[model samples]
Target chain A: MSAPLLSVKDLRVVFSVGGTLSRLRGHVTAIEGVAGVSFDIAKGETFALVGESGSGKTTLARTLNGLQKVASGSIHFDGKDATSMGRAEMKELRRRAPMMFQDPVGSLSPRLDVRALLAEPFRIHGMSDRDLDAEVRRLLTLVGLPVDFASRYPHQLSGGQARRVGVARAVALDPQLIIADEPTAGLDVSVQGEVLNLLNDLRDRLGLSMLIITHNLHVVRQIADRTAVMYLGRFVEMGETEAIFRSPAHPYTAALLSANPEPDPDRVHDRIKLPPEVPSVMARPSGCEFHTRCPFAQDLCRRNAPPLRVNGGHQLTCHFPMNTPAQAGLEQAQ
Target chain B: MSSIRGSRGAEMTMTTDQNTPAPALDIDALSVSFATDGGTLHALKDVSFSVPKGRITGIVGESGCGKSTLINAILGLLADNGEVTGGAIRLGESADITKLTPRQMRDLRGLQISTVFQDPMGALNPVLSVGKQMRDIQYRSNLSKREKDARSVEMLRQVRIPDPEKRLTQYPHEFSGGMKQRVAIAMALMMRPQLLIADEPTTALDATLEVATIELLKELQQEIGCAVLFISHHLGVIAELCDDMIVMYAGEVVEQGSVRQIFRNPSHPYTRALLDCDPARLHERVKHLPTIPGTLPDLRNRPKGCVFQARCALAKPECGQPVTSVEVTPGHIARCIRTNEVTA
Candidate 1:
């Protein structure tokens, strides 16, 4: 529909996992941050990147805005190839797709007030003479903050308030795609709702495409139209949010959903107790990266990595996919 | 389990009824204050609740709601400027925790009451191996060095730490966040404390790890027969693991009841709002979540009447008067003047 806002093909990112000394000695180990990932964000749709820590969600997010160098892949933004884009084209790509961080306090300058913070984005884009002060107040108002907040410094605001300011700054330039990484984390339940709703409202009002990277499934259920579950730098499951939650195609997705403690006490969950914590990225398992932790891992799963297979609207990489009556019961139980 | 429970409360084994056991911890009109540079800040005021023997009692509140302060006060680990102005913390029949000397409190800490903090990395020493840290906690006991090492391994096994022997030798940095938390839990339970206070223990964990950790905590508590005081802001976690729940706001108890009672029929406006605010509660995705309208009142300002009145949508003129808890059900209580009007 009207060309996807952003498209990626075999996106792979790597990092040297040691200090300068090791790099000089030519013995530095290479760690895959985002390994052979591919996805598309349709225009005006909210896409979610769901994963636990070290799942490459943040790495992929950084690559979207050209902040992280791509080891190999194509990032086509607004029908433009970002990977091969020249200096001017890359600048335009960044101007159209901004990134929002999880920690508002760390992202924001302590000395700057809300007005300056919001106006900085405009100034960076060379829109210095566009009544920047008035625009700052409008951004603050758009995110449901008091107009008077423009006068207050970041430190003076509460955690929720500061995060709202972060959202305001991200949307200051009216970017088509906003990459919000763990936006509602560390906020109170009510404040989380407030922030989520604010993002939803901004999307609807501005017709903005959102790429939210978060571990919180509840947020994905609420705001995201499509979801991609990442594990050890690769997508394990990707599909519509409703389909993924209703009947997860992959074992990791099933385990993750079942593990989410629903607020309802009466709704009994069939918790799939994962054997051990997610394996460190330094020593990612052979074959399927998630085979070590997958409950349905078999000899085939351990020997050869499953290709990303698409069925109906869902796409997953799993050898022994859980699509039987037993799997349906897990979904129904929730 | 029965043997430990019986031995701990031999003299005070009086049960309220055949169904209910004596509370492991009872607080009566407890008040705690911090001497700030500006003024004396009342962190907790007239707060009263009980952790029934062998049950999980959750203290649910947002930041600055005095949940951490209450836990610190109970553990005798409050900040230097903080003081318990008035109240009685009766642990057992004759043990008044508030009156205990510093040395007595230190002796009672790991032996009687232990705590699991929020950040596992901060709670553990990064330099020392897990075995060394765990064994250090058991050193004061009469057990020999060999016995202490065995006990550390056993506790690690109980928490389901994979390859317990190998894990014990690894430093904190080597363990994943979830594994570190498990080790922290194992260390907290190494002494077999009668009361375990966990302050947002799973807040830093992933959702999957968090559920597993909570399940482990529940299983261990049942096996050890210790009263647990779980402090958290996540309603989902509290709803799942807690037997009884306490809702606090701005240093005051706004609601207290059984988990079923609270979830099924929250009588307080604040609790109802909190539940409504949950993304899980919304069957269909909506544009804006129903917010509580305003932030919690500043601790320094200290609202005169109901602490939640400032942000509460159901606040009435009568809320300006002093508010005390009124029973909404058999054991459920809500500290709102208009408790009868509010519905879950």
Candidate 2:
């Protein structure tokens, strides 16, 4: 794949908890036992990150965008180490690799007009050409927004319009990589599809490599070229889209797939039901992070953490992979 | 279990029966309008559908689609400023919901109908214990305090809450988001009302927890004989839970049909657009989601035509006439001009 557009290796993040409480003086180490996580995204391949909240999906996404300082990791963009970039280099990278947030309005400056908002990214990147107005007009039209909307303020735009402005700003610097975090959250169903389709079209036509962090499996199944399933800060499964969906390699991935809404109504004959909630992030399980609520957990499975291994052209860190019904302790999962 | 598809109406209560005498809840020409600060907002227009005796009827729609209003209208508790301007919801021939007086509607609620609100914390009282909140609904019944407590505990356990005794003693603030939702469902089911209205029950929850909650609801509905009006923005959950379905858009019933008919052969343009955007279909290159691509028209000054016409893809000039729902199938109906044109 000639040096993939983006590559992340051995990423780790931790936060000290209970430090404020003088009596309970200790560190609640988060994201431990997650070692040497590595993945490569092809130039135009859209990679999706799916996991329960607190699975460090957001942690990994933030690390890539340089929003959250890395504890220990190396993020390489276009064969250059993003983690080691200087201030000027980082600023350049920031413009060329802008990020989109979940809440469209939350990320936008409420006071700024749509035209000014789209222009802000260009100005930040020091693109002060006389023809910038024409460029902004092209971007607005590209995102299916009317030109008359440019003078209107952010508050004047609808949720979808705000989202279009956000997209325009992200692509303003002509970034090769776009990292979107739950981009369609809280949008009306009608608007949600439009945004998803736009992202898909952008990836294929613009050749933009995107890292999508979301809990919606349907989103993952739709736009992703490759899928990586995270659990408790570590990726439990990673593989091609078709393979991952056809035969999930990790128990966590299987549970997640089973929980997702399948188009076929009769598909819900047999599948494991999710537990009521996820465990606290501070104190993760001793072994096999997903073993806590796993239907087939045993003493051997709980005693030791499974090594992240590759099988059938995929990376998985589960003792029990979602192979066949009988293999994953499901006579019917077949 | 697949046999239930054939005996759906009889084996389970809510699945519509070809021979059954009465639908669990029959709503006819129901319209809800609000006299808001903006103006008189036409929220729901000419909505009609029936829930089978013991199955789930998912009323799926986006925000401001009058989904909540329809639920409230059925519960006989339309908001202070809102009124059912037209139509009637009948629980057999005896109850005429549109004509019911406040006292009669009050009597009808909790016994004939119950509701589970989306915000567990907001819906629940902070000062009240879980047991007290549950018993409040069942208190008027002949059941004693101990009986109510036992039933409450059983209901909690049925919803898969661990250690019901400890949970009942704790207040709403003490419970987690998923647990609070469970307690709320437990309280609503405690009444054993003939009909249950769940308004966006899992929108505030994580996608995983939301799935488990839907399963619990399906299980509870099966065990109890009440029909469920499961309202949510999630088309996936609606497909999983509903036997018959109502697809609402901008305060109007855009499409109403069986789950199979709606999924495999959606008639209305809005309904077709919704299913097309579904994440399940996202695997391929979707050039355009073909969304009903405009915010719902301001309800106050709603144009005197089809509300979805502003955003609809197959709309014609004549669609400007007042939209009327007609029989699209033996049991399916839709209120759109291009119902036949939408190949979805």
Candidate 3:
């Protein structure tokens, strides 16, 4: 395969809690939001990150976009060293890879009309010398919105319309990569289908690589080529979307898949109900982070951290990985 | 007016079965309108459904589909601008909720019908401890403070909260999101009301926590034997947790039937489209998903005949005239003129 469009290696992000007073009193503590996670997105491919809130999926996405400070590890985009980029290089990177936030209406400036919002991206990157009006029309047409909608403000547009405007803005600079966080949230089922179709169409048309961060498994299955399951700032499982859904190797991944309620009354809902409490990042669990919630957890899981085991394209971190008898037998023999 | 009365009288006679008890809540041809600047916006137009005794009935609809309005009308908490323009909401034996006095409605609220809202934090008081709030809700009872505390502890235990005795003294902030929702459910059921209305109670929770909450709710509802009016936009949750389901569109109940019947075979164009729109139901990866083309009609100037005519693919010229609901099967109805074609 050709070189990946974007590559992240052992990336980590740490946040320090308490104010300066606490620091002076030697009471400061650090929490690893994204703890040494790595992944790669090929050109025109979509990669998804799925987890509950505070699992550092958003933090990892932000770190990739250079919005959050990376505590360690390296990042490479299009064969360029993103971690060591200077101000000019970083600004160029931002233009080449724009972000789409979660809240559709909240992300866009309420005061700006659709035309102004779409044109703001070009102006920010100092490309205002072009025909801004024609550019705005082109964006509106690209996202399948009417040209008349360009005059409407953020509040005037519906949720799905506002999301279209957001998409138009994200692709305004013709970025090689787009980072979308919960792209289909807060939308009705039909409207969600519209947005997903638009995104899929744009990816194919523009040859864009997308890093989608969402907890919606249906969205992941629909658009993503690869998926990673995050738990307590680490990837418990990563594989092809089809393989992950068909036979999840990690217990956490299985639990998450089974938890999704299917819109079918006949199907037996054999759900693995995890405990409600999510451990705080500040107070990390002793060994396997998911041991407390894993239904198949044993004494070995609590005392020793499992190493990442790779089988073909699939990789998982668990002592007794499901659906692979060879690995389970090897662990048992040990 | 006489025609409206005639239909309501017919419905009453049909539901008056001596063998079976009256439904916990029966809404007959209910209509609600809010006075806005443009005009009187009919939020609910001749809506009718019944929450059967000790059965779970789920209402599924998108925003602006009158789910919230229906809940408010049932609880007598509609805004000042809102009014029940037509029909009656009968609770139990003899109370027509539209005619109830404010004091009587207040008396009926927590004692006969209880509510569990979407946001647990908002439903619960931040200043008071869980135990204090639970005890305070029982002010209408003659039980002593000690008895109330004991009942609160038992309710918490029933909801599977660990260490119910000590957890009761903690503030709302101390509990996790799922735990807070569990506490909210406990408080809503503490009065042992005949009816429990859960408005997207598990929507704010994670997928794992959501399943857990649904199971807990199912267990508790069976134990308490209370009629449940579960309102949510999520088709999956409605299918998983409800015995019967109502599909609302443009402030009208477009379809309703048993959960099995509706899921197995949806008759209405809108209901079929909605069920098809669910990504989970699609087994194969497709380039584009099926979508309803047009937006909802304006409530103030509602379209002439069918509310979903503009967006429906199967709509015809005959749909321009007023369309009566068709009974697809026993207790299964669809408000669409082409139900025969769709079902066939």
Candidate 4:
């Protein structure tokens, strides 16, 4: 088998707050109970990480990007261990690790013009200053922005325009991988569509591999080749987008699908009303993590942890795979 | 909550007031323009729609489409810079909402029509107890203090809030996002306004909570028999709760018709793109999810041709006509000049 472009195993990150609290007794458990979590991203393929707020999706993303320090885990990139790599080595990786943030305006420097912003990445990687201007113009044209806008500052551009500039900046170093975090959160629907199209074009034209972390399912449906569904801190299901949406295997996966409002109004959206909120990580339930909220909670669920099993190239972490909506309903009723 | 009747559980009772002759809210070709630092920006253009007595009419558009501006104009509460250049919005029969004096508008606002904003957390005061705020709004009502208390609790019950009597004393932070919206609705109904203008009230909530809130609103409308002007960006939400829908873009009504008519036969390119935008829009998988191409044009230098022509793939030379709109059906209409070219 061909080697994967990126791979991670048993990744875990924890932050300990310090102050007037006791020296020995740790304060504030931000994230815990994360078991062996693993995934891979192939060349020119898009992998998606989906979960609601505070489900550890952001933490995992940061860890993968080498922004956040990890406690115990192994991250292999291009067949090398990146966990303990030096700053210079990581900087070499960072040159290729272009990231697009959620807020485009906030991400770009307010005082810098678009051309300077786009050229910074190229200059940082020791590329020639003479070629920078030509490269900036090419990147701007590729992103579908007019050359005149290069002279304008970030504040002068519209929200959509600013996002395009941010994309150009990320791809400035000619990176093989792009990690986008909620790329379209606050933008208008039309603008969001435009930005999505730009990203799609970039992926196809550049042959870029992408790892998109988002809470919006619509985004996943549009760009993802495969999806990983996260609950608390672990992936409950990982499969092709069509399989995940059409026949979600895990009970938690099925419940989440049931809970999301169907975009079509003619069809009454089925909702599995989970109690008010998900529990905190400090008090995560034992055995099967989702058994507490599972409608089919039994003695076995509370006594044993479920292992992720493979079925027709899909991985599901549920004792009983609930595929169809009717089957999920029956499990709940039982 | 005591001010309005919500016909939530009365499914058959909703039709009772729709057949009535009197118009509850009348907005005629209303246009609101803003004087920004840039230039004279026409936010709303010759927009016209009316809500029948006890019927729900939904207005849907994304940001900058002036959905909220239209609702605020009905209350005669435009920002310091905004002005209505043309048209009239009359509420409760003869009261021309645009020309009402400050004092008269005050009397007309809560008593005749109330607005439910999307952000319940921001709309509610965190410092004040819910009960005190309730009493403050209803102090001028005919009901006495004790009677108001009874009515307030009764209104809470009507909306299906658990432990209404206890909850009234707690602050807004004590409730969840959905519950906070219900409280906001209860406050809007305190005057029993003839028209309840809900501006993306459910957008702030999750799917389960959002669906329930709409169900609650529908039941409340049935009981009160009051018209509701529901505004949202989600067509799905509008279709579930509204009898009629008005599609807006830039500053004009691109399409208007019964929800069923508009959903099944969207006559405008903008409307079709909107329906196809949702990834989960259909039970069956789409070969490719359709998306509107370009961002909406700047309101300052508005497009001379069809406002949506810049992004529309079906643009023909005839779509360049700027001064005409076509009626596509018995009660449905679109502003696009290519009415015959595009099929619903």
Best by TM-score: 3
Ranking by DockQ: 1, 3, 2, 4
Give per-residue CA lDDT, model 4, range B280-304, as digits (tens). Answer: 5644434344567667798999878
- The residue-by-residue lDDT of candidate 2 on B1-344, one tens digit each, is 11112111222233334566576787766778989877898888767677778878888778778887887788777889998888778885566777888998888887878888888888899999988988887867898899888889999999888899888888888788888898888888887888888988987776668788888888899889788888878887777778878888877777777888788888888887788666565554444654665677888787777777878777778889976565566667677766777753
What does fnat come to for each candidate? 0.78, 0.53, 0.72, 0.24
The CA lDDT at A318 in model 1 is: 90
Alpha-carbon local distance difference test for all models: 0.85, 0.77, 0.88, 0.77
lDDT of residue B34 for candidate 4: 90
| Candidate 3 chain A lowest-lDDT run of ten | A325-334
lDDT for B223 in candidate 1 is: 94
In angstroms, give how far residue A141 of model 1 lies from its true place. 1.5
Off by over 4 Å in 4: A15-36, A123-130, A259-265, A268-271, A302-304, A324-334, B1-19, B103-112, B124-192, B202-213, B216-226, B282-289, B294-298, B301-306, B309-325
* Residues A193-246 of candidate 3: C-alpha lDDT, one tens digit per residue: 999999999999999999998888888989999999998899999989988887
Q: DockQ numbers for every candidate?
A: 0.68, 0.36, 0.51, 0.27
- Number of clashing residue pairs, candidate 4: 16
Tens-digit per-residue lDDT, B221-288, candidate 3: 99999999999878889889999888998888888778888888899999999898989887657888
Q: In candidate 2, which residue ranges exceed 4 Å CA deviation?
A: A20-36, A78-90, A122-136, A153-155, A266-268, A311-313, A324-334, B1-24, B35-39, B75-83, B89-112, B119-151, B169-176, B204-208, B281-324, B336-344
